[model samples]
Structure formats: structure tokens, C-alpha cells
Target chain A: MPAPLSRRHLLARGTTAGFFIVAGQWLWLTPREAEARVFDPQVLSPEQCKALSILGDALVPGAADAGIAAYIDLQLQAGDESLLIGKYLGVDTPAQTEFYRAAADNVISLAGDKNSMQTFATNMASDSLSGWAGPPASYVLFVLRADALDVTYGTPEGFERLGIPYMAQIKPDKPW
Target chain B: MVSKNCDVIIVGAGAAGLTLAARLAEGGKSVSILEAGPERKLGDLVSSQIWARKLKWSEPAVSESGNHKIGHAFNAGTGTGGSALHHYGVWLRMHEGDFSLSSDHGVGLDWPLNYEELAPYYDQVQAEIGLSGDSVKERWRPQGAPYPMPPLPLFAQSRVLAKGFAKTGRHTSPLPLAINSEPYQGRPACHYDGWCDSGCSIGALGNPLAVWLPRALAAGALLEHNARVSRVIRDANNTQRVESVEYLQDGERKTMQADRIIVAAFAVQSVRILLSSATEQHSAPGNHSDKLGRYLMTHPAGTIFGLFDEETYPHQGVTAGQLLSHDDYDEKDAAGGFGSSQWMIGHAIKPHDLLGYGTNRPDIFGAELEPWLKRASRHLGNMTVVCEDIPLPENRITLSDRLDRDGIAHAHAHHDLEPSAAARCTQRMSEGADILRAAGASEVWAGPRIGQHHMGGAVMGSNPEESVTDAFGRVHDTDNLYVAGPALFPSSGAVNPTFTITALASRQADHILSIN
Candidate 1:
């Protein structure tokens, strides 16, 4: 649930040092690294990306490792071709970037180092986050969780991890 | 301009458009279809849930509002096959009482045609599409030809949930589905993989890709992909007849002329197309009565989920669910509510996505997430309750003031659930939770009441003053323009609308053919 290995450092260093530290494991080249090795975010800021990764990981443990933030950033850059679950939830494509930013900003203001990540997540679920702005905290939590689930267990590999059959009539050549 | 003439020009390549196109083309008529989205084939339906997001409505977003919002993006789809490509294939007929809503309950508008008039077409469509179910087991089912295929095998979740219906003195029947149980009509049978929402790539489910698209293509129907229809064009000399259509294709505005035109772009989009057809000489076709976008309706529905001690294997069957109970479907005057409702029991569920087990429970996460998901993956029991939405003229679709980048006005859908229908949905959801508890569930919970299907707007009626179209789906104001989808429905029946949409299209095709 901790923040990603600062994008500032990834830029300061070269592509060789661009490694994601997930679940105490040092992966040489994760999917996130492979997809966006030199990350230049279009819609999301570094702080917003960090906040989304933390929030998503808190909701779904392996989501950070699943590159939820990268997946989201990629979709945001996709514009009308966004594959985000929020697209299906009635958040218009043009407004999706603002929606995610505002929600992430709300999370940042609420979780001012005083509360644990678990406490923040629980407050989010209960809609008890004081002075919360933007969309309802519960709704934001739902969207983030859904996004996390998308990356964590929405793929054939993820289904196999849970012992469910990955029966495919036409299998996806690549995970989004 | 890529100008061409055809016998018929159908707007939108969704279920209704494809069905009508296939039928008319089979009768030796040259058919042309304009689809707002990309071309989709059965081979494009990948099995991964993440990749499945591409199958949903990816066109310009439809603005929605009101207490129970019509879930346009979730319910509607884009591309060649349209929404039917990603549908779960739950095909149920509207009950006889569903035809006359105002006459029976004094609530919504009554359909121009009764179930008996539509029943023969429904039978013909069902037989053609190959529905699988046991008619005798469906005690409350209306009279029709028995399903062409035996019912799909029920999984453990359905078996467990059936006990709840039995314990509550209710009868359970195998869910009628458009999915093939065995290899039929050269299409492969379902593998019970539970990916219906992701689009059935194997041609097992009777999606447009497997059913109508091939027929339409084989019968020489020309489908124009990525061609977003702007408006229907009326002839200058004869204002009463629609002569052509204006549309955008490959970044160029083009016009296509035809002897006949049918707008089958689903409910909201269909209404948008008609409303955008407004000209100075005449208002939008079907707007003479000021009832073009009136009487919008969407079913108020929810799901009930539970954790059972026994191994349920919830993901072993179809996504449309495995069983149905219409024992109380026809009861409109129940104490708690005033609309018909039905229960689709035991869906083959996943751990993610909107209706999946994981997303439903945002409370269980962090360190305690994987175990819960794993357990639910193996032992979850779930069923959905679909309550009828009574049509209200105030709940309508209108052209939004804001326009898309392409200068086409976006469609705004406003729908407020009727108090009676809301009450009925709440009651059914509560009963569903109780049923889960009675079915030996260790824990049970109810999901939020969300909009299920979109229907009505540009409704059909006997009186031209009250409705946009006549019984034949032809607009009263225009001779050549017709609507052939759920948008033509006068009443929002509790059952799924795909079967009825196809049946209505069949009827419309017959009418068109008989005209000349």
C-alpha cells in the first residue's frame, strides 16, 4: 500500500534502475516497467499516481503489484478508448481524468499521516472520512476497488491464481 | 460522397437492426446498415474480463440522471453486433398481462398489440435463434412453442438456491436462455464457461454475431461500420416520407437513400436519432404529438448474494443464471408494490467486475481479501430480481444542449422510478435475502438496486396523438421511417427485452415485406 518508488528517482536514474518494489520483491522488469519504463504521465500527476496506487493496494492487496496505477494511467491517456471500469459507471470519458484526480486529492487531504492506510480504507468504505469532497467517499471506494479487481483478478492469469478455470473460446493475446 | 441506394437502410447494426436486415435480405431485398461503432466478429470476443471492457458502449457517453439512472454504458454496447454481443442471453417472453398495463393496473401505457398477436412471432424467433429451456417446468410461463433445446444443466449454485424456492412454497424452472445447449445450426454448444457478458466467441450464445449477422451477410446485406447516423432526411416534396439518412463515415458526412428506413439504434440512441431529425418545415418525425421522447422506462433491479457451506462452484454455468421463478411474476397488486417481477437464480459469477463477488463486498479487503475471494469463488450463491418499471412520460430522453466533438448532440436520459415499482423492487430484494437465508446460507447480503434494462421512448400506440409509431413500428408522421427495438415498447415488462425485440423486428420485417 506504500507509495511507488518515486517517479522523480526513476527519471533521475536511467531505465536500468527503473524497477518496481512490490511485496518486498525486486522484480527486474514488471509489466508496469515494460509498458511504461520511462513514465511521463499525461492525465495523472506523480502525487496522484502514488495516491491511487496506495488506495488501490489498500483495497485489494495485490493490486499495487498488479500495476493498477499503470493500467489506469494508460487508459486515461487512451481518451475515448479508455478501458476503465468508470467508463461503464457513467463517468463521461472527458471528465474521467478530473474525477480520478479529485478523488485522489480528497484521499491525500484526509490521510494526513495521522491515520493508518487501513483506517483510511475503512473510513472510505463507511463514508466517514470527514471533510471529504468530490464524489461520495463510498462511491470512490467502490470505483477504486472495482479498478483494483480489474487488474488483480480480471485476467486469465489472475483467475488461475484463484484456482478458477481460465476457459477461453478466444483467449486475450495480451492483458490490458 | 459515397452515395448509394438500397431497398432499405437500417440505422444501427445492433440486435434489432441485424434481425430485421437478415429477415428482409432473406426475402430478396437489398439491405444496408449504418453502425455507429466498429465492426465486431465472433472471433473478436476474447475471454478475459479486462479485455471485455471493449465490448461495452464505447461511443460518445450517454448522459443519465434521476433516482434510478438508466445504466446506458453498462447495458448498451457498440460495434457491429451492438449490445447483443455482450448480452448474457437470458431470453424470456412478456406475459400476457404485460401487454395491457393501463387496462390491467391503470398505471403505464398499454401496448398497441397484445401478447397473442406477438406470440406467433416470438415462437418463430425463438425457434430460429434456438432457446434452451423446459417449458413444462415453467408453470407460470405463457403459452408458446416449447423451447427447441433441452435446458442447460444446472450447477451446484442453482441446485442450492432451488431449495430456497422449494422451502418457500415457490416453484423453480430452468432459466430460458438463447444459449445453445447442444451443437445446433452449425454453431458450437456452450462450454459452461460463464463468459456470456464478455461476448460468446464460440457462437454458442445466440448473439447477433452467431445468429443474425451471418444471415444478414450471407443474404447480401451491406453493413457500414463506424457510420454514426446524424438524422433521418425527409423528402423535400413529400414531407411525410423519409427518403434518406445523413451520417458520418471515415470523417466525411455522407447521405444514403433507400425506399424504406428503420432506426434500430437501441432506446436512447434511437430517440436521439429521431429527435435530431428536426427540420424547419416539420418537427422531428413522430414529434407531432409532442410525444417523441416520452414514456421512458427502465427496470428497477438488484441482486442477492450469499456464502454457503457447501461447495457451490458458482462459476460453472452461464452468466445469465441457471434457474427462474415466476410464481409471483404476474402479481401486480401485491401489498408492497404494483409491478411484476421475477427471480433469476444462481448466476455463474466471477470474483471481479461490477456484479462480481469482490466488487460487491468493498468491506472485505487489504490483508483479508484473497481468502474471502477464493471462498466466494468456490462457494457463493447469487440470484437477481428484475422488477418491472412503469413507464412515465416525465422519464424521457432529450437532446442535451452540449454536443460531442463531432458536433452531434449527445442524448440525455432522465428516468425516475415509479414509487410502486421502487416498492416492488425493494420487496423482491428483501424476499431474495430471506430466500438465501432459507437456502442454508451462512451469510447473505443484498446488492444496490440498479437499473437493469432500458425500454420505451418513441413508444408505439393505436392513437397517433399519444404514440410515436403505430403497431407496425412505422412512425405515424412519416410513411417510410420505422423504429424496431425496445424503444417501441409501450410497457416495461419484467422479462429481458432481447427476445421481444427480435420478435417485434420479425413482425416489422413481415409488415415491410407485405407492404410491397
Candidate 2:
């Protein structure tokens, strides 16, 4: 019943949602919608996504449910057009996939029990984690935590939850 | 392999390029502007921080290395309005002493001309753009015409923050901003929604899209988006004159011949284009004296946050901040440190993102963040501290060995904060925390100091041997070549550069029209 979305509509709304493979067809959807549908990530591996979701949720509560992994995976697939917070934090889009993959591996390696994951997060924040490889643990922790924040608390709904006003002149159509 | 010819070709469509394009085209010079980014309209100025990243510089990533990186990707922007599209509208003029830094303080490079010479241009540009402020309260403001409109209204956050300045024996004045306070020049008044950094969509903010783009288009100036200019080509007959500009557009190489050329591609990219143009026959357009990409500068700025017991909703104002204090700005040679500093008080902020309070306190996370964020949403007060950067020859933009898909070299910016400047920033941040404490903050914290605005690289000066461009932004060795934008700034004056950049470009436009 809805007309097909136009480029002008997307620009006017400033949607952060992207196209994802749903039932073997490309569908424009929000990261939360993609996560609910269990859409396969185009760039990150299943193992990597699982690791990221677990660690991201551990870093910020409800991040996994808010689709942090799907949001990151979708942004990574966008390549140079990625709008992830990492773009502003010195990690360019071309190098983002590798950064996330290595960081996910590091998170998976240290994550075990709930208490252990919490300690690992603390250690990661302080850059004191043992056997941490790839980018500095503190920097990776900061980026992943920021990504989680983006998915969990950066939308109008999230602003409502925090008792803050989302007084947008041009509101985004979808919350990524 | 398309070729086009025009009387004037500007290699950017930002605040500087658009200002020049509008003036030159209206002056009867056929003008064409080549923008590297995609076309953008007022509708494209979205109100989300995540979507706002699309306005920033993305690809052929600039390689940065130094103790303090210039933050090229974050500070620079793409699309029609360029970086000004996402700017916060903090328009402050450089003090008189800022012009003669070397002459007065014996540090940093001095502007070729004094504030007296540039004051008229500043007045002219502000009138065209329409600034809002209480100039009488801004006692530190240089001799110039008052702002066109009254300052934007103060909110609870600013009212709470002003008490701190008063308690600390400092004065606070309404921040001079390019955002409209009322319906001025047909633009709507600001809603004070804290969306300035996400680009003002309602034309309340005086971005190029709202001020000059329409004027340029009406004057018959041509604008080409996604035209990535590689370099300017010197004429075979006259090495001192640029004949054409080579660029990539729509997957094909193109050439645009023009009688006059202006590189207004921000600071880093403007320097990069000149650096890439070097050949055996001639040095880069302004590099004959080896000062093409030297004296790179960015303001060493950071934010100070406080948790107040009073209910202070921090999101009811424009993002730039409500009040300003320049009490310590004029004293460049003070004891504990060197150079000027300012306080942009009571910034409207979000819960997340880089400058957000949540991100500043990286230690608080997991179950602890939400409650803290909910509390701070109604009880937080924050302000930014901007300190001057001492221009150093070693902090420069140079061509990198790595090439893009088009074989164009990447720009590598290296900048390290001077010891005295760093000391000054540190000292002021400490004072800022004390001010917040004096206002009865339960807890206080400060964000990491980072590079704010980019400037210099192709600095303007009187001596051709010591600087890249003349006071009018003409390249020393070229008759038709000029450089615009903040790239021509010889010193970072601890104030926002957009006003100065716009004023300087207006003066350049006048000079160009007069000569023709």
C-alpha cells in the first residue's frame, strides 16, 4: 500500500537505515528490524557479529537488543559511505571492517562468564588487558562502546527514555 | 575527456568559494565552482548526529601523524555547504593583538595586514550574512558595526553557567553567532533545538546554502558537484599563470580552462592541491619560497563538564553555547603560559557522541550509564575552552606517497601543540573546573584536548619568501592564481575561523573585481 521510497524522501528524512537481504531480496530496513529478522550480515562473519553483540551489550546494557551488531555490520558494508562514529574517531571506513573483526576476536578471546566479561571491559578501558592484539585495547573499547551508545541512546525514542527532548527540525525516518 | 572554459574557476563551494563566486559572477566575471563532494540542499541538512557524519570528509582518507593530529576527517566537510554546513555558528572576530602575534608577543606568525584593514571586510560580510549578538556587552569586540539582530535567548543551562563566571570574577556576554535570532533577511528564527552541529535545516543558521549559494546561482555562476580537482596546470607559455584545472568527474577526466583560479578547498585540501601541482618546470603555485604547506594550525580546545544540583536542562539552546568570556583572551603573554584563551559557556549537548557527557566519562558504563545519563540530562552544565595555537613551520601539510584510485596523492597533516600553548590550555581548563566548582557543581570533569579548527598551511603574509600568498591571497609567483578560506590564516587566534574566512574571501572578491 506504501509507495516505493525515493532518494528525495531519504534525503528529507535523513534515515540511517540501509538495505539488507531479507528472504533473498534486498529490503530497506532499520538495524533493529534487521536484527529482529535475523538478517545475515553482508560484511562481518556470524561469529564476529555474535562476539560484538555480546561485548557491546556488556559494555552498554540493551545494546545487543538495540541491534548494535547489525548497525555496525550494515555501516561496514557501506564502505567509504559508512556513517559509524568511528569515522569521526580517526578510524576511516576502509580500515573499519578489519578493526571490528580484530576487536571482536579480542573480545571473544577474553569474554567468558559475566563477571569475567565485566572485568575484561574494565581492563580494556584501562588498556591493561593481557595478550590484547591489534589496535590498542583502550581505543577499541572506546570505539565499540561509542557504537553501542549510537544504537542504544542516539535516537528520538532513546531521548524519550532519558527524559530529554528530540526537538528535530528534520527528524530521521529510522533509528539505526 | 571533456574540456570547458570559463573566465574564473574556483575549486571549492564552501563559505569562501561561494562568497567569491557570488561576488565575482555579480561583478560580470563568468565563474564556475568545482566542488569535490556531492550536491546538497537545505533538505539534506538532517537533524541527527549519526546522519551528520555524511556531511564530513570521507574518502581518500587524509593520513595524519603527530602528537596532536589536525582531525581532518572530523573538522572538514563535504557537500555543497562544506564544513560550514555542520558548523555551530560561533562567529567571533579576532582581536587586534591577534593580527600582530609576532610583533607583540614574539611568538607565532603575524598577519600581513592589521585588524584595521580587515575590520571593514568583517563588517561587510556580517551585514550580508546577518549575525546576532549584544555587541555592547562584548566589550572585547574590535571597533566594528554592531550585530544585525539581538542575541538568541538564554536558557536554564546558560543562566546556571553565568553564575559560575560571576562567582569566579569573570564577565559573560551573549555569544556572537551567525544563527538568526529573529526572522532576518527572510530566514526563520532559530528554534534553539541544539541541532546546529547536525546542520540547520530551517535556514536559521547562515551557512553558504542559506547566504551565498542562491546569490551565486542567480548571478549565473556555474556549480559542478562531485568534481574532484586533482591539480592546477600551469600554462606552457607562461609558467607564472595557471591555464587549466584537471579534475575527475563522473568516472572521467576533465579539464576546465579559466583566466583566474582560486583554491578555496579548506586548509588541508587547498594545500594538497598546490603540493600535487609541483613539476620540474615550476614549483607548486605558492611553494617557490618553500612556504606552501607550512605553519599548519588547529585550536587546542576541550570541554569542561559539571554535574549541578539545580535542574539545568542542557539541550534547550543552540549547540555553540549561550554566553562567552574573553577576559583572558587579550593577555597573550601571561605568566603561567602563553597565548590567548576563551570560554564558550553553556553548550547544548547530547547524551552520546564525541563531545557528549556520557562519552567524556568512559569509565561509567554497563548498568551505571543509563541512570547517570538520565540524571545528567536535567542537571548537567558544560562549556568549551579554546586556546590559541602557536604556528610552527614544522606542523605542515605534505603529499603522501600513497595514491588514490585516480593516482592523486593523499594529504598528510602533521601538527604538534607547542609546549607553551599546551600549558595555557591546561591552565585554563583547571580554571574552568574551579569556576564550575564555585557555582556549586557536585562533580566536575574535563574532556581530552583535541584540535578544533584547521587553519594556515598556505599562509598569507607580505614577504613572498616567508609565506605562500600575499595579503590579498594571491600566490606569490602566479598572476591569476589565488588561495582562499582558512588556509590563508597565518595565525590561529583562539576564535572560530568561519567569520574570518568569510571576511577574508569577501575582501579577496573585491580585490579581484577591482583589478579586472
Candidate 3:
């Protein structure tokens, strides 16, 4: 059997064009450049939304462009009416807002070094980040990545990007 | 006794309640169903997984405590059809041994009626709902009527995963599904787009909306939505006879008198209703023996995932998976295990959500995430292992001290898997990985063993001292009160409980009709 694709090679190919290469260091382009700027979030504070966008984009490329922050903010504002997958995974509907706010605050504190988003995410995944508090960093990372995936690759156009057929019985109007 | 407004009042508009309502109404009885959730129409059944969350249980959450907490929010549904609206159409019958758990192995409670008594009802329900499968190929399946429609065609994903069973010297058969493979009756055929979890809008899957609600409406069964039933009220003169049902509709406490009542609001809620009926005058009905909320059971289930070299195109078939292997279903004494188990193979998975390929793997993210997910979306092959849970009295559902906004006590489920049942789950998961590897999977991984089909709590038995209900699902303490759903199950069989729930409800309806 052929060897598994190496991480280094995958990253090398990933940084070619879509990524922002600044000062010989590759960084994910901020979501602000891709999405609309004049947006009013209902639930998340400005800082919390920014942190979510940055962390979400770092975890899943193009998630910001897919409106990850807006999606999460909309869901959080919906309270019990939220369509988030976290509702099914033991996170109560009322606590969903606090869960995201706390995680986003933690992300802002940890991701201070803008040079390496991947390294920051790796530390979050392993829970090796110093002074980490609240719901485990790994869990937050998992939920964020899942939310990002929902906005990015869970739609018909997103399926196109992954080369999978979107044989939806009734197509969704938007990713929501 | 209070004046009666209806002959029968069903607490929930779910699979069991709706089925019973249709049957009872058709038999010239006035039936009224009180549903807690908002009314759901076929057009409301959107195909988006994100939008599909609307179909799930939205009532005040059921507090859970257990080694394997039942995914109640995900598993239980709300609205007109209840949980069956989002069910994946995996219709399966319990093996004969499943009926007599204590009689056969001295573990768990035994059913009041044996498999022979329920077999005819099962056949009748299968025919009524229109199941699809090859009965002959299902060697382990109990004797029953053949499926009305042919089995759903295996998509590329199931075909690729079937190779794993073949390579491992295991047998597989077309999964018996309540979905229509071809146009049957007035319902259209399943387009095989894998959207059954989002509620089959095309009326192909035999959800309550497609199978029972139409018949119920046509039969003039009064249906009320957003009506949260509080408790069944007993007659002031005689506590043995239920008089009426008190419920909250439009934020007003209302009482609807009925000659008979059936609580079919799934397991925990059904038990909660009974437990909440505790008044100053009398203890909750069926609590005389303190067995009303005991033996709460849920199947120990988890998915085993693999990435095959072949382009499996894992997003093709139904969400319930395309094939089933019940080879060890009746082997309660298998080595290193104490219960039955089965594998549902080749689920049509998605990129997001709790069970999605992207979410399960938390370790893989950032640059490596997209590539891995893209590959997994195409090459992934996954199967779910469902193992029987031993019914332990300690694994119970009780009324919690905590109250919801409506001031009603919440239901709390406390479950701990028996060691033997846990052992069975572990053994099956190990075998699942091996099967995937044998099928030429380069990598194989398994998800955490979690709870599936919730049952028991108010289980049925011949002895009133040991169980809450009788053979016909009539509560032992009351003459007109019945429990018609998986909540009446005495054992947690390693199969989806909807088919059996429908069957039991059918039998209960027959009994009720015959008496009147």
C-alpha cells in the first residue's frame, strides 16, 4: 500500500495561493477580507465574534468566507431555537451562548501570536496552552471546527468544493 | 367519573400514539391526540441537516446521568410525528429470545406476552406501514410476513462495505426498512438521496406523518398540537379508573375527559407523566410496587469508521445504512460477551453534524483538516454496532426535584451499563474494526460507545408486583390507562425499537377495541 500523505507536504501545497504569506511565514487570510464588513452580530460581542472568526478560519480554511461568525452568532441569538449541532451533543440550548463566548474569550487570550495560527490550534487541541481555563480547550476546538465545517463544507456549494455530489432531496436556501 | 369527551386520549403524536390513534379511530372510536411540540407538516420537513434540528425534542431538557448518556435531544423528536419524523426508517423486529430475558438467562424482566403473541401484530404492522427487504436473505430474522416492497438498491457505499463482511466471513442482508423502494399505496419511492434523517418529505419513509397521520385525520381523530400533557387524572370515586387528562394548551391548564388514555410520549417523558401524577390523595398510578420508573434501558451503540481505498462515495444510501449483519444477534452466550449485537453497515454520512466525518475526529484540524475531510467524504465506510443493554433496576428514570419554567418537575435518567453488556459492546467494536480492515481499509477508527434506542422505565410483565404494565400494555394499577411504546419494553433488544413499538401498540389497540 502507498504511504499516507505527509503533513508537511500537504501544508506546503496548501500555502501556495489562497493563503497569505507575510515575512516568510504563511498565515491564513483574515475573514474580514472575504466577507462583508458592515455586519451587526446579535449575540456575540465584537471581540468574541472576531476571535471566533480568526480561530475558525485557522481551523478550517475559507470558513470565514462561508460566514462562520455570522452563522454562530445567529444561532446563539436564536437561544433555544438554535440549529447548532451542540444541542445534540450535551450542550443545553440556554448555555450555548455562554459556551461560545467563553471559548471565544479563551481563543483571543491564547491566539495572541498571529504568526502561527496552526501552532496555536495545535496547542489548543493538545490542551498544552498555558493558563487555559473553562471547558477543555480540545473540546472547544472540536466544536468550533465542527461549526466551521457546517458553514463551509456542509452546503451544496461546499460539497462542490470537496468534489462530492449534493444530491439533496430539497436543497437548502442557505447554509444557515 | 368526569364526563367523557373522547373514547381514547393519546398523550403523544409519535409513532406508537399515532399508529394506535389511526387503528382505534378506524375501529369507530373517537380518538384525541395531545402533542407537546409544534405542528409539523410535510413541507416543513426540510432536507438540510442544520434545518433538521427543528424536528428534535425542544421541550425542557431531560437531565441525564450515566456511563453512556442517551442522546435524547438527538434521538427524541418533537412536533406532530415526534421522534419518528426524523427516524432513518430502519425497521427491525426483536428476536424471539429478546422477549424472555429473565426466563431465558435470568437477567432483566420478561415480557408478559411471548414473541408468538406479538408476531402476528408485527406482521400486521409491517404490512400496514409497508416495509422493504428480502426476508429470505435475513437468515437470523424471526419468522414474519415478507416485505411489501423490494429492498432498497445498494448504493456504491453499501456495495463497498459489504466486501468487508464477505472478507471477514460474516453474513449480511438487506436492512429491513420502513422506506418505500418503489411506489406503494400512494407514497412515492425513495429517491435514495440519504435525507431520511431530515424527515422524508416525499412520503417514502413510513414516518407517522406519511403512514398514520393521514389515516388518523381522515378517521376524524381530534388532533391538538402544542398541548403538553401534565398527568392522567384518576376518577375521584375510584382511583382504578382514569377519568381525564390534564394538560397545558395555549398556556392555560385544561382538562380533557376521556374514557381511556394512553401515554406514548417516548420513554422518559412517559414515565415522567406517571411519576408527576403523585397527588395528595394517591401515589402515582403503577407506583404501588415502586417499579414504575425502574429498569430504564438504552442500547449500547457506537459507529466504527474506516477509510477504504475504494471511492466508496459514502453519501448515497439511507442514513440508517444499507445493510445489516445479525449473525450474532441471538448468541447471548457468545465468548467474552453476555448479550446480542448487530452491525448496521454503510451509513450515508455527511461532512458536518455530530456523527459527521469532520466532527468525530477532533485531532485533525487546520491545513490537514480539509484534505482529510475531502478524502473521507468520498472514501469513508462506516457501520454502527448496536449491542443489547442488560435491564438493571438501578438504571432508572425518576422525577427530578428541578422544575421547568412551567413548574413541572423534570425527568432525570440514571443509567450505568452492566459489565457484561459493556464487554459485549467492546467485543463487537473490536470485531467491527477487524471487518473494516479485512475489507481493505487502510485505516479504521471507532467512536465512543454511546446509548441508542431508549426503552424500559415502565416495562410490562404478567406480575403486577414486578412490572408497571400488563400483557396489553395496560397499567396494572388502572383499568383505562395504557402505555403504548418502547417504554413498555422489558428488555433492550439489539434492534431499533420503532417496529416493535408499533407492533405492541397494534396489539394494545386490538385489545382495547375487543373490550369495547
Task: Identify the candidate with maximal TM-score.
Answer: 2
Candidate 1, B1-516: lDDT as tens digits: 324499999998888999999999999999999999998888788887777888788667888889999999988888988888888999999999999989988888989999999999999999999999999999998999999999999889999999998998989999999999998899888999998988998899999989998899999999989999999998887899888999998899999999999999999999999999998879999999899988888889999999999999998999999999999988888899889999999999889888899999988888899999899998899999999999998999999998987899999999999888899899999999989989999999988899987899999999999999999999999889999899999998899999999999999999999988
Candidate 1 vs candidate 2, TM-score winner: 2
Which candidate do you rate higher for DockQ, 1 or 3?
A: 1
Per-candidate interface C-alpha RMSD? 1.1, 1.0, 1.3
List runs of model 2 lying over 4 Å from the truth.
A1-16, A22-27, B1-4
- Candidate 1, true inter-chain contacts retained: 0.84
How do the predictions measure up, each by TM-score? 0.94, 0.97, 0.94
Task: Point out the worst 10-residue segment of candidate 2 chain B by lDDT.
Answer: B1-10
- Residue by residue across B366-427, what tens digits does model 2's lDDT show? 88889999999999999999999999999999999999999999999999999999999999
Ranking by lDDT: 2, 1, 3
Question: Where does the lowest 10-residue lDDT sum fall in candidate 1 chain A?
Answer: A13-22
**Cα RMSD for predicted model 2:** 3.2
Model 2, A1-176: lDDT tens digits are: 23444567645655557887755666667788677777678998878888898888888898988999899999898888898888887887788999999998887787776566788899998888888899999898888888888888898988988989999999887774
- Each candidate: RMSD: 4.4, 3.2, 7.8
Residue pairs in collision within model 1? none
lDDT of 3 by residue, B294-406 (tens): 99988999899999889989888889999999999998988997999999998988888778888888778778988998899889999999999999989899988988888
B38, model 3: CA deviation in Å? 0.7
User: In what order do the candidates fall by TM-score, top score first?
Assistant: 2, 1, 3
